[model samples]
Target: MHGRIKGEAAFRRYVARASDELRQANYTVSAVDLIVTPTRTVEEVILSTDGPKGRVDLPIAIVTDRGPGGLVEIRMYFSTWPITGEHAIRPPLLQHDPNVHEKGAVGDYQRALAAGDLAATLAAFEPQATVREPAGGEYTHTGTAELTELYTLFFSNGGGIPLEHCTVPDDGRACALEYNVTQWGRAAMPPEAGVAVYVRGASGKLIAARIYDDSNPPLHRPDPSFAGCVL
Candidate 1:
């Protein structure tokens, strides 16, 4: 039979250390309670906490094996609860890379236009991409080569593409960017026009893109003149 003992000293020490670690890692811990089993082999810890989005209830258990020397293993479980308060939830440390990717994509597009880097701009787009313009028709292109040709003509005729904002979906599968363009030509252009571009990617490479603009229904115009155009 295994001997049971209440080792309060050891349990308190472990809880203090764990709490400090969690705080250092930027996790908000509140209302913590710790209890050590009479046998001193199991410790239960509970706390109210919040994550990047909302509040949660976290319960952790530390188990010590029966032995002459003190050895411990800890396990943590998290559950969310409805709480009303202003709490800033912390983001996961391991998710920095994906967050960086999203920022990079937005920055790339902005830089491309500011520097007039056409090649770099196109490089940011997927192979099979579709572009919709406010007064212009939709153009679907299959590859980089075709897209470049279209961009070349558009820029040659004195066109300006300006991005306003982008939204990354929570699922991380797609992004929608809002932009405007001004074309200087004999034809009169609207004072303000916008385009919403929806993009899907895999492994950081764009695989599909579709654009929504004023030319189609939201507007009373459906110019089909630019059909078969790529870019």
Candidate 2:
């Protein structure tokens, strides 16, 4: 808890405070992600903290409860379990096909991803939109809250994941894009190739997305989509 727990702003303040405190204590913190949903708040911070003993790598997950007023409580979960996952993340191995025209929304996504513009990237999605990552997994992301978590974690660790398209389907209702994502730092896995499907809503904004890629379970496959995707 940071403040009187007023609203989302207060919640964000708490997050900033947490990061600040960690840094001030000679602990270098790299945030993995932060999720502030209607009922829950979770933050994943990777810390390299030093003390009398020495320096150690710590993957820290901080969780908190959320209420109408704001954040409620906090806790931390740690594990000796190592972080491992394979992904085909790199600068687009192949160039974007000159002949293929890209969709506006999809194109915006690609540019935002390259620029590491997290907020701009998120603004492309509808509030209740759903997203599936580049690698097929047991989990799917739905709504703004989940999306926030997905991107937050990604931009924190994933760095600038550039995508060079090999294909962009002509179909307006459904478009599939083949891409290569960039691997996160220090926590590197195998390279990954991904396909993302982008579908438009009646209002013409992206409403749903699904991804298919070679990323393994341990690596966090945040966003990569457009082929073999279902609406």
Candidate 3:
């Protein structure tokens, strides 16, 4: 129990013990199988168990990481209801990095916008970051400078902007934001409404962002509102 358990056999034994414990408690449970992924960082195991009053079917997925420190994360994905019926359960989003805070991510982006801090805003993103447009479109920024330019252009336009909500799913590596942008200024601003942004990254940085929106077509103007804006 002290040393590291290596290979499938060791893992099976561990699962067997856990299953037996449940059996003793009059719970119907079984150890299915262990899956070792190619990356070696993730090991997923499946468990099929039953609930009380013979009314529930519980299917659980347990994910583990084989690193310097062995760690396991268990999640229950499906469970049977007591009166309604059997249905799939929506698992709550869990963050992988404990250091990341949802408020920090949302606050940083908002602060950067208010201060027009291009460098700071871009700094929050990963080196290769992609931002998807509202109309099933996408744009990838190669460097921090380029990302800053995009941010600058976005705020300079006179538009009614609102950040509805931000959720950090799968522990800080990804975030989903619901927002709306309306109104527009000549030669620079674009009208928008009801936008959804999905951001994913690691190490407290943003790697990718997928945006979905239903709005008017894209407009490209020659003269931007912030003609002399910098930094």
Candidate 4:
């Protein structure tokens, strides 16, 4: 995969290569959901195609930010194992440490996560809020009962999953944060990059949180039945 391309010329070249690769793979992409704000837009996309084994569908998230002049920035989030057929650590995207000082509901959520307090984390979400896990749709946790069970397992490691927030794109309705996972609970690991979109409700609490990371939690166990690569 092309790591990081700078300049319009380089970006165009990378796009050309990607187009060729996808065409050769007979891949087709379709949008699943979209969230728009004054300055930001997040799209949940699904890429499908027939592969050597059979048909496969891969889910991905794309975040875009706009500015007064024109485009500001764009980033894509998805697990590479789906394409490479292997699980490996992702390299950090940001060269330097990030300055993370969030405000509003997102700030509260971040603080709660750092504290690793189950009650506080639950309070950050609406009564019937939903959290979609990174794997896919089947892993979504909904409502208090399900969320309670999810976070209970999450905080069992004794600390919060700390993320070094890199870029936060928000315009009141929702906020998308590009971050690097620095640590999970008491254990630390190599910085792994990921992105998540947090949607806010009328009460300023979270309505939904869609995560796009493959970071293994301390309690995570691999399932042999699941195949990492899709189409």
Candidate 5:
């Protein structure tokens, strides 16, 4: 879905237009990955799905923009996922997260997590909100500064890892996210599943986020430095 309108208005319009058709198809959209400019202006849109058209809610990496700028257009994809050869992955999508109780909140939260974008990720939380780890308190943060530090480490060292998240707990603020962490320094990491609860504040910004995951001995990286890391 592409719109030339300015800012969030354009995004709202895009969602409005897409919701009806998606609902009828029995496809629950937990989130959409959008590409906005450095100015924080949304310029690109991608929706992945499998339906009447060739639109792909393409499994993992749904939509990508090849911007030269003309009119805004939304491209849908079908059968997008891990490694597929000739066989096309199509509808009656059996595996999908139905935890989209709050569309906007869940969408922003999950998208930011997938993109590994720090600002967007933090923006989803409330300033005084706490982020708990399934591991322990030693790996938790509540304040903005602390959360920022925690995420800085996460984004730097914990990227390029494939993650799939969907709404859970019956369309509430909770999301069931599954991913793989390769290393925790010398320790071996395994495939993990976790629930991330995001709640909004008075201003509608994410007020708090609590994460619970299964990663063996937890993600206490020995060298949690952001030296050469890039977001």
Candidate 6:
């Protein structure tokens, strides 16, 4: 149920196994939005059926790349917290309404995040905005207070977080970015694969930023406790 699968037969078995497991668990999956480019497609989906405890909402993004022959690659981005309901207490990001797509707002957010400007970043969000850390629900940051704390720690390295954007697909409600983490502040690192979704609100501010990545931060100014924070 983890890592990459090779070969068409192995991939088929993997899909079958996943289908069987989801069906056995009584989970229902649905697509929230889809965006297709010339050579790639991104589908935002939600799995909010049944889990070990009860109904849990898990938002995911599936990215597919097209080759000359057919589909060349598929990557799914999500955390397993909703599936296991482990240390999760926050509400779902896509419970009632999906995020609205505002490219302007998304662009502002990207600038602020890339520059590591905490104030600018906060200004790009609504008053009650939330940021779900890549780790899981337990690390969700809501409101200005929590978000301030989170971003302050984030920019402690004295510079911005650099990303090598691969593909960005946007429907009307959300923009999913496929990226590779190349640097954090002044430190350079090996390319680490990751994906993040920026959800815009009616006011043209970001309501949520959901990250699905496992990149380790190279902290120049480390905090003793940030709840096992990562990119």
TM-score of each: 0.39, 0.49, 0.39, 0.81, 0.43, 0.70
Candidate 6 local distance difference test against the native: 0.69
> Candidate 1: where is the Cα deviation over 4 Å?
1-102, 127-138, 166-170, 180-189, 215-224, 227-231
Q: Write the per-residue lDDT of candidate 2 for residues 6-56, one digit (tens) a residue.
A: 567876888798788668658777874444444655555666766445655
> Alpha carbon lDDT of residue 118, candidate 4?
84
- Model 4 agreement with the true structure over 65-167: per-residue lDDT tens digits: 7888877777777764455554456676654346656668788888888778789889989999988766554667789999897787777666887777877
Query: For residue 90, what is the lDDT in candidate 6?
Result: 21
Candidate 2, overall lDDT? 0.54
Clashing pairs in 6: 101-173
Report the number of the highest-TM-score candidate: 4
lDDT by residue for model 3 (1-231), tens: 112445678868978986786675456545533334422221112233344455333323333434455555322222222213322222223323334334555457645544546566777677777654322212334556677666656545443123323222333434443233322223322322232333546555666544433333223432322111111
Q: For model 6, where is the 10-residue window of minimal lDDT?
A: 88-97
| Evaluation by TM-score, superior candidate among 1 and 5 | 5
Ranking by TM-score: 4, 6, 2, 5, 3, 1
Q: Write the number of the candidate with greater TM-score, choosing between 1 and 6.
A: 6
**Number of residue pairs clashing in candidate 2, backbone atoms closer than 3 angstroms, sequence gap of 3 or more or interchain:** 16
Assess each prediction's global lDDT (C-alpha) against the native: 0.39, 0.54, 0.40, 0.73, 0.43, 0.69
lDDT of 3: 0.40
Residue 1 Cα positional deviation in candidate 6, in Å, after optimal superposition: 6.3
lDDT comparing candidate 4 with the true structure? 0.73
Off by over 4 Å in 2: 1-101, 134-137, 182-191, 216-231
Better of 3 and 6 by lDDT: 6
Residue 94, candidate 3: C-alpha displacement in angstroms:
23
Better candidate by TM-score, 3 or 4: 4
